[model samples]
Target: MPAPHSRSASTSVLASGSQVQPIQTPNVPLDRSLLLMSLAEEFFDAAHSIAPSVTLSRTGENVEVYEKLISTGLACLDTALSHVRLAPRVEANIRLRYAGVLYEETENFMEAEIALSKGIALCDRNHYYDLKYAMQLLLAQFMFKKSPKASLKALDSYISNAEAYQHISWVYALRFERAAHSLESSSLTDYHAALQNLRSIAKLAGEQNDRPIYMMASLMEAMAHLKSTGPESMEHAQRAIAAVWAYQLDSDNRIPQLLGLAHILDVACSLRQGNPTVMINKLKLMQTMMDEALRDPTWSTTSNVIAIPINRAQNSSQVVSPDTRTVLGIGNDGRDNLMLSFVSKKDAFSITYLLCGMVFLHRNSTSDQKGFKYLETGLNSLEADMRAPRASSGVLPDCIATLQWRGQIMCYLNCYMAFCAAAITDWATAKGHIEKVETTARDFDVPLVGPLGSVLVYLTGVYYQGIGDLDTALEIFQGKTFELPAETGKTNMMNSADQVERDIALLAALNSLWILQDGDRKNPSRNTTLIARLEPLCKSHPNKDIETAFNLVMATVETHPAAALFQVKNCLRAALNGAQTTANTQFLCITLSVMCNRFFSNVVGAQAEKSAQAASVQAQKSGNILWRSVADGMLAQCYEVNGKAADAKFTRDHAFKLAQMALPDI
Candidate 1:
């Protein structure tokens, strides 16, 4: 409750006889000024109470009360700012308050920016260091849309201002924001700096007893670590998860979105470490938590932002002076709400659904029949969200930012699903997803040169290859130029040069292998380029096993048939004994196909019989019936070459039957 002020000057009483007497202030100027000051004090007190009420209401799940209280607070701050006698510092704060309130309650960003910029100008003029630092810190949220470079400049200014004011906690918060944006950079120096900044913020937040800040820093740091393909990433992920859970246990009805993000990072970490079981478990938990916290049964009717009528100031057609002040104050409670709200429930749910399907498909191929249902549901949800107006086009920068982020996520969802469908031999469905991915990228004006773009491109090419569109696949792999949307084609921080290059190299080599298999040896220049790319990678790439698969292809196409056979055996060994299913499956089929060719080539010698038998045995052991069919077909060729007509006829019949069985139902 706000402290009450005496209303003697503003209130009047009626006598028992029904005659009313107007209240009068003393004639002395000092006395009259004091009364007016008292009224302003009442308004300020009202403004102060608004934040706590909104916070309490939000945590209590009284969203209607929360909205009303925020509206009331904005009204109070407006009234207070209207007073001519109010102090300059108080007036400036009221303006900043209005900006935040207008932003949070109505999604009126233009109005908010006007209020915030005016507040900053007034604070600068008056030398109100404390208020200026606070307003600048809050301004960082709006700066994200304009320019990261400009936002960093403002944040640095805020940090310096906070230091001058001796507000250490404000400095910590400013640095925390810097750390988050830093993680979005591609530079190693920037990443290392971000990691250090997060560590410092975590420590400072801990010392200041700011658990939410600490937990947020921990999660951000965990995300950074997950991006790293280093040995300590798992340990870092576990530590961050522990920190988030610790906070969750202590806080009642904590933001489920925060925990959901942490679990998402955990799932990524688990995937990198090749632990599908752990990834599945974490994803299920994330799904349950987000569903309980954010699910709306009537999702179709819900707008992601509030639908409030424009206030008087927004409706005004008059061009006002820069000094023109508008009264506004928003409760601090809504900032976190606004932040979390940017991540829609549907986005979270769809991502979780897709991840679950991927884990199922990768770890247990037999479950693909069941898994496709989840994938389809997730895909449908993403497509629906993509088409929804609120998510695709919005009036505010935050809305636009959310739309771009969600668009990127949709691209990834499509890319992954396309690949997974291909892996399960669902060629038609995979091609459908691939076409959507291409169309979405074109429709959304997504960049085609970055890390994600490379993945989508690779997957599209692979889908073409799977469906026997060799010419189209070859054309895509042959092209190096990729387009990005004109406005949002900022250099992608998420997709590093190395990552994009590696995917290109792998795709190019795969194209070359197919071309060679088609007996198109005329294009030696393409093979030359591919050999140059694969040779250095084979010796130094971190995933040596994957590089070896590249090497196997190169050796098969360029070197002796004997050497090609040797490389094939090594890849088969790695796929069987050393590699994760995800990594193994990629080159496993190609390796088997090459091995079958080698076995047929050696049909005249004792090695022919041994090679033929080994190919069939290994293909069956790999649990890939398609490869088994190929193996049997090659063995039949070997038997015919050896004049064993009866054996050849029997083996050819069995191969035909196996090929029929290997076809996907779809």
Candidate 2:
């Protein structure tokens, strides 16, 4: 793969392998300098090309080859540096670039970032734009993940240097990196500018080299169109997906291709206006294949520097929910993998939203039981991020929205966990956690406008919903202010498929409201105006989540015992099945157990009996003491449900006894 190393690249006095005899500066340094310098330049170029092979082998086999290559390259460079006629700055710039290559190859990101920064600075200071361009490319991968701010500076320099070099691809790559770091508040100007830069690069795009960058840029632009346009967004998305497929992007840039495609399809599905479901299925298949493609190879992606504020690209593209990236097989670092190996913190930042969206999407996507683990794992992973962000411990003011949003997710997370505990009748912990969720939500203000609105509505409703007040949750869920058309969090960063998740979150929020709203409508929450406010949505969407929730609400109502049973069973079967598949088993269990208990009106024996059954089921599956107690307590309630007064009293004693057995301290 390498051009042959030639002996002519170096000149020798005595000819023992071009080994330099010490030079005296005074005599005749500039005499044959032109010829020697030319030769030295060729060797330096060769060394740069051969440098990456150091990573290829550790065995004796290519060891000498790499060593010889480096030595030859270094020998020529050493001679060049030693040239008495050369300026000190010129020699230092060259040496600095070589050091950058070394630090980069060794996976020493900190030193690498430092070296490359200094080297590029040296190039800038000397006005050597071409050399700066080359080294800037080397520094690209580090920009977004480690330091978006610094990355932007480097990328700016890279772009300036690139323009001088007339390397169009470099500009496109820089745009992509810029888009990666765009924050929620970042305006459409950033998106537009990035798109403009990308389009400019596409003008110079060619087919001979299999233009992955062109394909990727096209895909990104198409998605951007979805957000910014109405009638044309679909057309752009369709055209983008087609280009990727037609260009056989599957084999070339499979990861970005499938991800982009998945994003569009997911958005379409979430919009729920067309046959987006079929497209979502097809996208999943492509995604699987894409994952397979990334199996063996690890490609290099160096970030570019851009000093200008990222211009908003056209968001005509469908707002992709953040969920599309978390699907495993995306080759996330394994738990054991060193955290330092990550390419960019921005990349990691993007993943968190995607994970949240996945959980949301999974809960709503299907009734299939198989999807549960995926959803749960994603949520757990999202929950795991409660630890402070790794990029920096100090939260920047710009990230307050992110922090609050995270708190909102925690509210949902805690509720989901509480529901799970309740499902098995694990009352004690479930009650405590649910109360905690209530407290968290109370402290949080659901802003009337912005991303937090929808989430706030969802979180507030879920808390009340968890506490057996589905009516109130439904009223809140109906607030359109909270319904973001897409993953608002990704206002700039890649708007992967987030709409689907939003739809699901809506469903859960409404379910909380309607299910907890009691049947005592004579007072009708006693608020006729409130009930009227929800009539429009119920008429349109037919109140799906709340439909079941309403039934659960009625189940708990004093008047309709059988209807309540039916409603509780209906909610349990559907919600449980849905939650199980999405890996949101906790939600499934919580809804079921909570609904079941509500129907019994917190009757002593009934609550214990129902909980006991669910707990038994859990124990068989997990062998946990908490689950066992729930089952035992509920079994005691079954005695009361049997209408035996003495048996009921006896069951209570046994219930207390079982609770102690299951929880020693309690």
Give the TM-scores of the predictions, in the order they appear. Answer: 0.66, 0.42
TM-score top scorer = 1
Cα distance off (Å), candidate 2, residue 44: 25
Go through the candidates in order and give the clash count of each: 4, 69
**Candidate 2: Cα lDDT at 247:** 60
lDDT of 1 at 450: 64
**RMSD after CA superposition, every candidate:** 11.8, 15.2
Q: Candidate 2, which segments miss by more than 4 Å at Cα?
A: 1-127, 134-161, 177-185, 206-210, 222-235, 249-280, 283-287, 299-368, 376-528, 531-666
Candidate 1 has an lDDT of 0.58
**Measured by TM-score, how close is model 1 to the native structure?**
0.66
Local distance difference test, each candidate: 0.58, 0.44
Model 2, position 102, has a per-residue lDDT of 46
How well is each residue in 517-552 modelled by candidate 2, as lDDT tens digits?
A: 445433444333433343343322322343343333
